[model samples]
Target: MEKIVSFIANLINTQKQFIKDLKELKNHKDIMVKDDEKLIQQFIKKKAS
Candidate 1:
């Protein structure tokens, strides 16, 4: 019984960490997308000029 409880606790902690990492990855992706958009716009403007 004790081992089962410990195993379950560890699983929960691992899941929480995974979720946190996923959120950070999502935020990073969003930032990258924004940066890419800015770069594209700058390139277009430069080309036009």
Candidate 2:
């Protein structure tokens, strides 16, 4: 599950540069529905920081 989530996050990251902020990732509620929220949140937070 982590691997799958990581892959999905990686895909999302392709557009992350356009994101412009960590808050954007936090507001993307639809992502929580498609993947593990904690995992994705952590990943995005770490990368954003």
Candidate 3:
């Protein structure tokens, strides 16, 4: 019974950590997307000129 409880606790902690890492990864993706958009726009403007 105690082992079962400990296993559940560990599983919950692992899930929480996974969630935290997933959020950070999502934020990083967003930042990269914005940067790419800006670069594309600049390239377009330079090409048009």
Cα RMSD of all models vs. native, in order, equals: 13.6, 13.0, 13.7
Q: Work out how many backbone clashes candidate 1 has.
A: 0
lDDT of 2 by residue, 1-49 (tens): 9999999998898667545454565566754534556756666666778
lDDT of 1 at 35: 61
Worst 10 residues of 3 by lDDT: 25-34
Give a tens-digit lDDT track for model 3, residues 1-49: 9999999999999889766654554465443544645645544454478
lDDT of 1 by residue, 1-49 (tens): 9999999999999889766654554465444544645655544454478
Give the candidate order by descending TM-score.
1, 3, 2
- Give candidate 2's TM-score: 0.31
As a whole number from 0 to 100, the lDDT of residue 7 in candidate 1 is 100
**Per-candidate TM vs. native?**
0.56, 0.31, 0.56
Evaluated with TM-score, which candidate comes out highest?
A: 1
Q: Rate the local accuracy (lDDT) of all candidates.
A: 0.63, 0.65, 0.63
lDDT of 2 at 45: 66
Give the Cα error of residue 47 in candidate 3, in Å. Answer: 40
TM accuracy, model 1: 0.56
Stronger candidate by TM-score (2 vs 3): 3
